[model samples]
Target: FCFKILNFPAEHIMHMAIGTSLSIILVTVTNSMYAHHLNKNIDWNISKKMFFAIVIGALAGGFVSKDLAAKTLEIIFSVYVTLVSIKMLMDVKVERDPKATKDVFYWTVGFIIGFKSTILGIGGGTISIPFLTWRGLPMKKAVGISASLGIPIAMAGVASYIYNGMKISNLPEYSMGYIYLPALVGVVLTSSFFARIGAKLSHNLDQQKLKKAFAIFLMLIALKIFIG
Candidate 1:
């Protein structure tokens, strides 16, 4: 939104990357910590396969993004997000997998999720949770693992954005590589407060409804981007 639709000034794409990474990092840490405190199973063995592949993909994505034209990137991201939104909006039933996924499959999915997360400047939860659940893990456990995966994805993306923007000329003021300080500060402040509220609300809410609402929201954003 910032870069493509809202027309934020130079380095807005990088700013979005860093800002999103920082915000998701905070949320991921908090959620994963709370889930861990509850003795939830995080599937560390699976996470190991995912983390290794995802981190590399995240870095590669960030670097690859640096070379794309702004319009091209915007179209690609908008289209991808739109398709994901549409998929989430549908009420598709997936059979739970009782068996563990193959190592190659985990690595492949992890890399794709990680790369897309960086390219989209969003966390992998939306993609990973569904994938994990489809692979036969319970929803809660899948969410936990996805949250944990955010750490490496965000870290790699931030580093890559920083590296990509390090020597770019004409970036906005108060910038650290691709990270715009003001944007990061603002998002961090709101994310800290809202994360707690969201956590609390989840316990009381109909998650299916919430998911539908979120899908609608994403659809609107996608429409705006495509129209722009």
Candidate 2:
């Protein structure tokens, strides 16, 4: 959306998304931590394990992104988001694989989720929820764990993007590293208001159908980007 619709550089938008997402994530996580009803499903052990591994991966991704060309990042985003959207459209029912959670599974999946989420400027939840649910975790538990992990991933990505972006020259105005302050601030101002509206509306909506609709929209946006 930032790149194709908003006319921003895709790579810089990646950095911008990560930076802005952190603020929204902080609010959500904090609310999750305090919500009494949601407390029962949180597995701190799994969350911790994933958190540590993902942070490491996010750091590595940040360094790698430093040398990646803007055009390359644009292509990467287009392809990856397209694939993810298609996967969402498939609506594959999540069946528990009783043996899916091995001791090392968290580390391995966490690393990949962190790396890719950072590179693509997303919360790892897009990948984490489905993977965890398929791996025998309860859906509530998966959501809880993934939400907790978003904080660390975004933090690591933010730090990395800032440090690396500072070294580059001729970046746009009001950028701290690659994060465009105006865009980040704009997101902060608008996201929370709509998020509340979305949350309230979700209760009355068929979530699966909504997700499918959203996935199709994303695919259209991605295809437009790809064609251009």
Candidate 3:
């Protein structure tokens, strides 16, 4: 729906809003379910922090005008995020502290994940998972918590996009702002199922290998966006 929205008639802002809203709803629901069924021991404090970061980041990212400048920013940010993902993957080490304080490290990690998630369509797991594991949480626990944390990130990011989209002038038809319903529906329906499968598979894989694979996938997507 997002891609369609990009090409939709300039007068359909409401449609775009609807599509973005629906996409976020779907993302949240799927993430919640994954958390419940897969990771039942989430740390509420960390989850709350991550959620707040998502909201702030989404609000900021969503408000940017959809112009040549915005597209440029998107490409630049994508490359930066992809590099960060690769760095995290390469520097993987087993975390030894599970009850660490909410210090500078925690906030820095959370902010990066939230900001990148807002710019990209991802749920922030690509960054969150490795950070959590590096902070000492078990891989299963990190995945579960990250999945849960993703709900708020999607909600806030989509909401921001929808809200800002409503204010866009001369937007395309069948768009609410930056959203396109049909595309959103298709992606959500397909991605949700695949995300669940991925979550399940994470449990059976080697943590380091999984992180590297995810990092590579993120980098590829970033390159695609940059080239597009």
Q: What is the lDDT of residue 84 in candidate 3?
A: 69
Extract clashing residue pairs from model 1.
97-136
lDDT of 2 by residue, 1-228 (tens): 563466656556555555545545545544544341245656787888788889999888878877777667668988987888888888766666555466588899999988987787777877888888777887667766776787788788888887877886756778788677776677656664654455445446876797799888879878886787
Ranking, TM-score, top scorer first? 1, 2, 3
- RMSD values, in order shown: 2.7, 3.2, 4.3
List model 1 lDDT by residue over 7-101, tens digit each: 55643564455444644564545655465435554778788889899988888888887777666766776787788888878957566657767
Q: Name the Cα RMSD for model 1.
A: 2.7
Please give the ranking of all candidate structures by lDDT, highest first, separated by commas: 1, 2, 3
State in Å the error of residue 65, model 3.
6.3
Candidate 3 local lDDT, 70-121, one digit each (tens): 4555556577768866785777465486756565666667777666666655
lDDT of each: 0.73, 0.72, 0.63
Provide the lowest-lDDT 10-residue window in model 1: 10-19
